[model samples]
Target: MKLELLITRDAWQTQVAVLEDGLLVEFQQEPRHLDGLVGNLYLGRVSRVLPGMESAFVDVGLDRDGFLYEGDMGPLPDLADADGIEGKFRNPSIRDLKEGSGILVQVTKEPMGAKGARLSTQISLPGSYVIYLPFMEHVGVSRKISGGERARLKEIVRRLKARVSGGFIIRTAAEGVAEEDLALEMQGLLDQWALIRLRGQRAEPPAVLHQEADLVARLIREVLLRADGEVLTDDAEAAEQARDLLSSMGHPREKVHLWPGKPGSLFEHFRIQEEIDKALRARVWLRSGGCIVIQSTEALVAIDVNSGRFTGKRSLEETAFAINMEAVDEIVRQIRLRGLGGILVIDFIDMTKKAHREALFARLREALERDRAKSRILNISEFGLVEMTRKRSRRNLERVMTGVCPCCEGRGRLPAPWRTAQMIAETLSGRHAPKKAVVTASQEVVRFIEENRDRYAFPSGISFEAAETPRLSHFTIRPAS
Candidate 1:
């Protein structure tokens, strides 16, 4: 499969599209002014420690305080009890800290909605080939790198651990990397961590110690460096910067290409904008005439699969299985494209055959394996529902591209015309009914009242007036002259 990265940079923001086999699989956008906060390190002062919640709020110099849970405070030191037994370990608690105490924390998740940024004391510095864990002591390799290569990388990292101060996680890009290269990157990260600590010690509380790299550099390190791909960008300056970054990372700079296409036409040229528009919609139609309706609520996302127009020339069980199997691919694709996270409930058409259900579950698991975000999929329940969860670090595409609908107040529906008519009738039939009253409402509501005139015993002096309004439920009954 051919993999490519399409980067479009403008004054407002930068957009990146990842295509596999000429199809868009993932998309990301980063604003020029407000880069993401994830991976940033700050020296924060604890402002509030809530022992009841087992969490604390640290003043990180942001609009809102960063939230730190006890579990994310890193590995606890083994404290001995009165018996002084060596094997016993004490769990860390939030009560150990007091207000106004200083803590060096890293942002693990960005501030979402009304919530503050999620912070962790266990910091990990990501490099091109390896991630340096300053607090962790274990050496591990990427699960994607398997067989003999995994053993080789593990052996290399274990040997390098003797020289480095902290643990190391071998990235997938380091699968075939030489031991010397890994050692070089590991040293670089260790030096970086040292600088962060020195800065935190010298700086005042609530000060920023380190900021993550820009979007381009992060993309190269995390995405392009891991795969064999051509990086095409419309911005000449960005292209040069990408080449320089790749060269600094010990990779060939030739992979970065300058696209001579029209300015602001890169995404349009690749039809990525169309794909993005489609992803924002609730209903997605599959090639086999099956469709999936995705609705995101405050608590979880619900996806319903329907056999729209495709009627299989097979048994009932076969048709249900076919639609579900096809829906799995689209569901996974949409999930990644939209960057959906948190709890997700998938409702698939029911199939009676146990074998078919098992096969469907297997296919879904296989498809989700390609997703970069960490996800957990539960076995399909007897009601043919699949419950899953995906890690969400940043805002999804829909939230970024669109705002809540003001007309419906984000409910996506309006009051029915008949319902509005009932409200108008109730006002007109009040005990202090006006001798002369005018009912003003949207054209639909007015028409409903006029058509169902016999249904309501409104005051004889009342008159109906249709007016243009944004909401059908908006109506007013005022005394007329």
Candidate 2:
């Protein structure tokens, strides 16, 4: 498949889009001020501990509190340094934690939506192809290194693990990685984390102790190399950045391309926007006349498959099986394209035969294997519902591109203005509310309220606040007696 990446960097934020065969598969936007905070290590303080929950709230100097659970903190070992400081930790209870305690932690996951960051005491830093785990001691290899390369990579990590004081996990990029390359990456991570520690020790609470890589570099580390496909970019600077990153990692620069175009936005040159729009919609039509419906929620994404206009080309069982078969591959790709994670429940056209279901699961698994994001399939039930999960460390593609829906205020729906007005009227129908009720709303919604003001009974004292109809406004009710 032809893969492309279009990067546009401004002083405010950097945007990257991954296109497959000229179709956009993923889009990312990272603001300059917030940057991206996943994979950073910090020396944080325990701000509060809830023994009931067996967790602690940490002050990482971030805008929100970072959560630390019992499973996350691990155990402080009885093996202690002479200074009474812990050399290791045993599994400890929540009561072991106290406010004002000093702890070293790393961001295992970024804060998404209203959630704070998910943190771990096991800190790991990435350099080019190797992830350095200063607190860990084991050597590991990317499972992607198969056959002879897998054995060779494992030995390399084992050898290095003995020499280094900490642990390291070889990345897929480490396949065929030279010795000098490994050494440099080790040294770089060492120096980088050393500086972070130095600065963190002196910084006060709720401050940035360490900054992760820029959006571009982080993309390379997390997505570009993992995708194992061609990289294309329109922005000149972005092209150069990719070249340096790939070439330095012992990959060929020929795979990276500098796109030249000016027909509308550069991302549109590859139809990235169009594909993203489909992801936002409730339904996606397949070329074979089949269709898939995707619904996202606080917990998971649910996808439902319908034959749509597609009648089985063959017999009844054959048609259902074939359409579902096609959906297997498409759904897997969508998960990666959308960066959907956590629990995913897919409703496929049911098949009567067990062999068919098994085959379909095999096909789904085969497609998902290509995804760099870690995932596992539980099973496809008799009802044709397949459940799986993709690991996530940051916001998915949708959240990265779009903000909350204004009309729904993220609930996905708003009460009709007329209905809302009636609710207001009912509240003030009898009980005397303030003199004038102010209805603040978006330009569109406010217009509806203004035209229907006489409809809802208004109390005498009720007055509407500056009801210019907020750009994306809200409503206030005034009871005119």
Candidate 3:
């Protein structure tokens, strides 16, 4: 499988589109000014503690207060019991985190809509091979690294961790790495944490102690750890920076390539703009004439699958199974590409056979396994519906690309022009009739009102004069003296 990271930088924003085999799989948009806040470390002060919610609101110098859950406070036993307290509950109450208490925290989730960012006090700094945990004192291997390799790597970390001052979670990239290299990476993370700790101590509350790397560097370090094909960038400076970063880390700098396209943008040359436009639409069509309608609301996302025009050569059961299976692939791709999160309920073409439902459910899970964001899938229900939730760090692609409709005010529909005219007529009739009433609206609506003036039952004392305006379904009535 060939994978490419296509980077596009403009004055407005920098976009990273992950393409697998020339198909857009994942896309991220980062504005030039405000980068994402997921991994930022802050010295925060507790603003309020809600005992009922088991969470505390912390002032982290953002527009909204960061949310600190009870679980994120870390193990209380490790805080107190490690020093000899016994039988004490490990989870402390939120009330214990009183207002004005300063604490070190890192953003785990980005702020979305009205909610603030999610924070954790169990600070962790991530490196290429290891994630440093300052407060803990053990080594853990990534679950993805299995068999004897996991045991071997864990032993290596255990032996080398004594040289460092903190715990380390061996990342997936460390599966076959040398012990010396792993130790070096662990020490780098520890050094970073030490600096962050010093900054946190000296900095005032609600100050940023550490900021994450930029998008290009971070993509190389975190996501595109093994660039199977190449990382293509339109900007020369960005390409050079990526090459330098990879070269400094001893990775292959040859994988970072500059796009050769001239006159036209890289995304335009790759035809990515067409795919992006398709992603923003509500309906998606599959190769076999099946379709999926994805609708998003404030609460959750609902997807309905349909076998549009493709009639199979076989039985009804076979056709339903085939179309449902196809829908699963597209649904998973859409969820990842669009960054859909929160509660997602998918309505598949109802299948009667229990085995078929199980097969589809399993396929859904396997397809979503490639997704980097954490997600959980529930078993297919008797009603042939599957429910799931993907972890949401920042706003989804749709929310970021588009805003609430101005005319409809996000209702997705506007009032009819005739209805608006009637309301205008009613308001004018209720008031003391003037010699002339001026009605302002769009050209079409004004013509409609003028042609249907007799039907409106407007008072004879008022003569209606239509004034053209650009509004679709809006108008105003005023007396013309």
Candidate 4:
């Protein structure tokens, strides 16, 4: 599919964009110092346990405290009768662990926004093709690999894990991989984990015991695992490093090619800049001439579909279906591109025919399946709203690249507030209402009107003052003027 990767590292941040078939599919950005720790294992101390909430606050050397709930805790007893502890583990409270208790933990989620990092006491370290979990003792292959290959993979893991203490989950990338390669990955993970343990013993509580690999290494180990695509980087040093890393891992040298663009960065060459321009807007245009409007709040992201100018050859139902069908592809792409994690509600144009809805849902899932991030679709509501959530490990493309806007504070758009109040004053002055009249707006708009009372060139016959107007959008006028 011609997979392309762009790696750019600066003094402040490291960014990587994964492009599939010349379109930007996913991107990750991380500060140079606080790298993502989704798979690394650590030995950390329990800082606080709240029995009331059934959650604990842990200190993992990050700026803020991490959260560990009883639900996120893993691996309670499988059998109930053998151990009376089984029932206790069912809804185990964080109160079970006292402060100062030592436990081996792994980062299942990265620290983002106001929330602290999420962690698992069931420590696991992932290799290029395997995940080494110290809590469990078993050998398993990726579910993506099945039939005879699954058996062969299990056998190889069993052989390599003969005397190993922890468990290994064979990654899907390990499919068709040679036994020698698997063994090397196994050894690499185990060795790295051992080193991390040594550092943890010597390091202090607020220290970095183990740091995950850089963006270049991470792309090779995590992203670009499939063979059907190419990795393109503009930076000469990063390109050479990627080639070396991929070649060392037996990836075809020809597959790792330098981006041969005449001008600008690799992102510009891939038309990623255009894709990004499309990404920043609330309205997204589909190739079929249909479009979608996305609105994001702290609670969830809402997407509304429209047919735009794309007209079909046949019936009304057919035309609507075509635009909606086209929208399904763009919707999935936007969800991934925006890295909009958490609850996402998509409002597709309702279809009267059941067949159209089924087709739309199928196409949507088919598109979303390609995303490496985990997402679960609860159901397509009777109102035609599709509900889903994407798993966010590292910072999404937008959060990594841009900060909240200073003027609008990430609101994206604002109406003229002071001007609106002035217009209202003029309308009220011309039309005499009851004995008394009032004007209102946001505090900022009100302040502008009050401060600019003499400054306004409007006739003195109209008088205006700002008041607490609950419904006013900033910089917007009222009275329909």
Candidate 5:
């Protein structure tokens, strides 16, 4: 499969599109004003420690305090280990932290809605080939790399572990990487961590010690390097940066291609914007005429599949199976493209046969294997429902691209004209009703009242006036001059 990375950067924002086999599968955009906070390291001051909740709030110099849970405090030294008899490690309790105490923490999840940033004391610095765990003792390899390659990478890390002070998780990209390259990257991460620690020691509490790389550099390191893809960008500065990064990483600088098209045209030429618009909508139509409707709430995301128009030339069971199999592919694609996370419940078409249900579940799990986000999917139930949870570090695409409807206040529904009329009638019938009242409302509401004058007992002293208002459900009533 061929992979391509297209980047568009302007003064407003930077958009990155990852295409697999010339089809968009993942999209990300970072606005200039709103820099992402995840992966940042900070020397935070403990503002409050709630022993009852086993958590603490840390002031990280952000708009909101970062949350620190007990589990994220890493393996604390066990009291029983005072004698150094190889005692087991224990998780630190929230009571161990005092108010106004300073701690070094890293942001694991960005702030979403009312929640502050999720933080952890276990800091892990990621590189192109490995993730350096400065405090962890475990040296692991990516589960994707197996057989001799996995063993080889593990052995390489173990051999070099004696020289370094931290653990390493060899990434899939390190499967065929040489020992020298791994050693170099490992040392670089160690040096980086050393500097972060040094800076944290000297900095005051609630100070930022390290900030994560910008979106373009992050995607290049995390995505482009793993896929060995060509990077296309219209911005000369970004193109030059990509070339320099690739060259430093021992890759060909030519992989960073400077597109001749005008700024923002690269996405249009590849029809990426069309895909993005489709992702924003609730319903996504499959090639087979089947569709999936995705709805997100505060708690979880719900996906429902419907076999719209395609009536397969087979038995009912076969038809259901065909549509469901196709739905699985699109569902996985949508999940990645939209950057959906948190709990997801999928309501597939009910399949009676156990064999068919198992096959569908297996296909879905396989398709989601390519997703970078870590997810756990359960087996499909008898009612053809699948429940899964994906790790979320940042806001999803819809939340990033759209805002709550001001008129509906995110309810996705508006007050009916009849409802508005009823409110108007109630106001007019009050004992203190104005002797001469001028009511202003939306055109729809005003037309409803004018057309249905007999339905409502509006006082003769009251008159209705139409005004174009952005808030459809809003209206005003004032004493007429």
Candidate 6:
């Protein structure tokens, strides 16, 4: 499958879209001024220790203090158990960390909403072929690497583990790499970590020791290279940076393209805006006339699938299965496109046949494997609810693009203005009827009351006047002689 990465840089933010066969699959928006915080190393000061929560608030120079959980405070040793499986050592408690103490930490997750970034004392630096864990001493390999290949990579790391102060985790990209190349890669990572530590020692508390790579470089190193795709950017400066990064990494620089400024946006030119619009909506329709509704809560994301307009030629079970099969592809795509993470609960249409249910479950599992984010899917339950989770480090697209609705307080609904006006009229019609009643409401509500003024027949001396107000739901009454 042909893949391409398109980047558009504006004054405010840099937007990235990944396309497979001309279809937009993944999208990211990062502001120019405020990039992501993940992977950044900071010299933080413990601001507060919460033994009750087993966490601490750390000042990392951000507006809000970062959160440091006791579990992430240190690199607990890993030892092999009798069963030959690695077991974690005891973790340090939050009480061990005192307020005002200096701590070296790395941001594992970005600040979301009211919460600050999640910090970890066990700092790790990731490279193209390996991740250098400064506090870890165990050689590890990617779980994706299996069989004889995994054994070979592990042995290589095992031989080199004692050479450095920390251990190395062989990444999936290191497969089949020459020993000399692996050695050089590990050395480079160690050198970077050394530099970070050197800088951190001299820096004051709440200072940044290391900043993660920019969007273009990170995309090239983490995504584009793995996907083997061409990178296209409208910003010449960004394109040049990508070229430099790719060339330094021993990858072909020609794959990076600098698109000349066009009359319209690159997103519009590629028709990616349409797909993005669809992603913002709660409902996603499949070509087979099935629909998926996605709703996100603070705790989890809920998705419901329905057979909207699809009626099949076979049995009802077969029709539901077919629609569900189509929904699987879209559901996974939507999850990636929308950047939805955390716990996910999918309500698939109930299927009576056991075989059909199992088939749908298998299909969803296969589709999710293509997702880059780590995810776990649970077996469908009796209620047809499929529970799953996707690892998240940054805010999702909806949170970034939208805010709470002021009118409905984000409930997505509003009380009918007509009904509200009718209630006011009824309340004043009884013994509390005044000589004059002035109803102040939104423009729509004022018009509703004026058009239906006859419905609220004022008593003989009573006068009614409709006044428009900016507040959508505000209403007022007064007595006039």
Off by over 4 Å in 3: 75-92, 163-166, 431-435, 443-455, 461-471
- Candidate 1's C-alpha runs over 4 A off are 75-91, 431-433
Backbone clash count for every predicted candidate, in the order shown: 0, 37, 0, 9, 0, 0
lDDT of 4 by residue, 1-481 (tens): 6777777666777667887776787777667786667765555678999888888888776778778888777653222123222222333456567798654566878777788888876657767788887547778776578999999999989888887667899888888889999899888877876666666556555455566777678877777774456666656677788888778778877766666764246666566668877787889888888889998788988899988877778977898888888888778888888888888889988778888888888999899868777889865779888988887676555665579865566786666766666665565556443224344557776777677777665454334455554345533233323
- For all candidates in order, the CA lDDT equals 0.86, 0.74, 0.80, 0.72, 0.87, 0.81
Give the lDDT of residue 426 in candidate 2. 64
Candidate 6, 1-481: lDDT as tens digits: 6888998888888888898778787888888998778999888888999999999999999999999998777753222222211334446678877799877788988898899999988778888778888777878887778999999989988887665567777877777777877888788887786676667657788888889987766766667766578998888888888888777667798999877668236788898888988899999999988899999987899999999998888888888888888899899999988889989999998888899899999999888876778999999899989999998877787888789876777888788878887777777777856756555567777778768878766555544455555446767777664
With a 3 Å backbone cut-off (N, CA, C), the pairs that clash in candidate 3 are: none
Model 2 misplaced stretches (Cα beyond 4 Å): 75-93, 405-407, 413-481
User: Which structure is stronger by TM-score: 2 or 3?
Assistant: 3
Q: Please report the candidate that would top TM-score against the real structure.
A: 5
- TM-score sort, best first: 5, 1, 3, 6, 2, 4
Cα lDDT of model 2 by residue, 187-218, tens digit: 78877766666665566645565667877887
Best by lDDT: 5
Q: What does candidate 1's lDDT look like per residue over 1-481, in tens digits? A: 5878888999999888998778888888899897779999988899999998999999999999999999888743222222221223334578877799777788988887789999987778999999998766789888889999999989988988875556889888887888888888888887887777667657788899899998888877777777888899999888998999888777898998888878998889899999999999999999999899999999999999999998999787898899999999889989999989999999999999999999999999999877778999999999999999999887788988898777798899898999988887777777886879888899988888888889888778889899987777998778898
- Global lDDT for candidate 3? 0.80
TM-score, cand. 2 vs. native: 0.82
Sorted on lDDT, best first, the list reads: 5, 1, 6, 3, 2, 4
Q: What TM-score do all the candidates reach, one by one?
A: 0.92, 0.82, 0.90, 0.80, 0.94, 0.90
Better of 1 and 4 by lDDT: 1
Q: Considering TM-score, which of the candidate structures 3 and 4 is the better prediction for this target?
A: 3
